[model samples]
Structure formats: C-alpha cells, structure tokens
Target: MAVYTVAQVKINDGERYEKYRERFGAVLQQYDGRLVAADDNPVVQEGQWSYEKIVILEFADLDAFNAFADSESYREIAAHRHAGADSLILVAKGR
Candidate 1:
C-alpha cells in the first residue's frame, strides 16, 4: 500500500524557508518522492485553524516513506525547516 505524509507548517523565516524549498526539492528527487501538494495560504472551508503552509507527499509504501524521511538527504534539508518553520507531520496509509 502507498503511504502519504501530510505536513502543516508555519514559516517563521521567509528567506530560510526559501532555501529549504530548493534543498528539499532536490532531496525529494533523490529519494523518488512524489509531491502531491505543496501550498502556502491554504483555504479552510469549514474549520477554525491556522497554518502558513501545507505539503503532502506520497511514497510507494511505508518503507519507502521511512527510507526518505530517515535518510541523510532529508536530514540535511530538515535543518533548514527547523530553523525556518514550526511544523506538524503525520503519515497515513493511502486508500
């Protein structure tokens, strides 16, 4: 089964986030991750909530997701995210 990762982030530093944007794309490519959605200023149709940005990624399976998430490439990109944003990430098995 495929696995999906959903991340909601509030960017604290725009310049640093931009740097992460580039670096993260490269890391995703290296790991064969598919970008389902990458959006800023998301619209909430029926909820009281707040988020600066949202990203959704799809992997071949749980192991593939784990491989990418735990890889060195991701680690390097993660530092930029740590400095740039506050985020919540969750994984779910796709239907």
Candidate 2:
C-alpha cells in the first residue's frame, strides 16, 4: 500500500529552511518518493492551523517510506530541517 508523510512546520529561519527544502528533493527521489503538496499559506476550511507551512510526500509503500526516513543519509540531511524549524511529521497508510 502507498504511504504518505505529512509535515506541518513553523520555520525559525527562512534561509536555513530553504537549504533543507533545496536538498530534500534529491534525497526523496532516490527512494521513489514524490512531493504531493507544499504550501506556505494553506487554506483552512475548518479548524485552526498553527503551523506556517505544510508538506505532503507520497511513497510507494510503508517500507519504502521507512527506508527513506530511516536512512543515515537522510538523517544527516534532516538535521538542517530540525535546526531550521519546529515541525509535526506523521505517516499515514493510504487507502
């Protein structure tokens, strides 16, 4: 089954966050992950949204997603994201 990674981020440093964003696509592509959506100003139809940005990623499967997320290379790159923003990241099994 396909899986999705949803991330809601509040950026502390735009320059640093841009660095993370720029490098992310290359890493994601290696794992067959695709960027589904990314928005800085999301339209909230109902409840409040506290985050400044939202990013959605789609992967071939749970295992693929896990492999990408758990890889040492990704972990090293993710440090930039961690340092640049406060984020809530979740994984969901797609229907």
Candidate 3:
C-alpha cells in the first residue's frame, strides 16, 4: 500500500527554510518517495486553514516513508526545517 505524508507549515524564516527545501527532494528520492503537492496558498473550501504552506509526499509504503523520515541524514536536514518553521506533519495510508 502507498502512504502519504502531509505537512502544514508556517514559516518563520524563509532563508533558513530554503536550505531545508533544497535538500528535501534528493533525500526523498532515496526512499522511493515523491512530492505530490506543495502550495504556499491553498484554497480553503471549508474550515479554517492556519498554515502558510502545505506539502504532500507520496511513498511506496509506510515503511518507505518511515525509513525516509527516520533516517539519520533526514534528521540532520530536518533540523533546518524545524528551526525555520512551525509545522504539523502526518502520515496516512492511501486507499
């Protein structure tokens, strides 16, 4: 089964966040993951949306997603994102 990672983020520092963004793709590719969607301004059809950005990532399976997320390399790069923004990230199983 495929898995999806959904991230809602509010950036505090753009320059620092760029550092994280720049390295994200290469790291994701290592785990058979792909960026599905990334939006700075997403259309709100219903409830309140508090995030400044939204990102969706698709992976071959939960294990692949977990491997990418839990890797030491990713943890190191993720520090930049953590320092640059406030975010809510979640993983969901694809139907």
| Top model number, lDDT | 3
lDDT scores for all predictions? 0.88, 0.92, 0.93
Per-residue lDDT value at 90 in model 2: 98
lDDT of 1 by residue, 1-95 (tens): 99999999999998887788888878888778899998888888897766778899999999998899899888888888889999999999998
Identify the runs in model 1 with alpha carbons over 4 angstroms from their true place: none
Clashes of 3: 0
lDDT of each residue in 12-95, candidate 3, tens digit only: 999889999999989988888999999999898899988989999999998888899999989988999999999999999999
- Against the true structure, what is each candidate's TM-score? 0.93, 0.95, 0.96
The regions of model 3 sitting more than 4 angstroms off are none
Deviation (Å) of 10 in candidate 3:
0.5
Counting clashing residue pairs in each candidate, in order, gives: 0, 0, 0
Report residue 14 deviation for candidate 1 (angstroms): 1.0
- Worst 10-residue lDDT window, candidate 3: 24-33
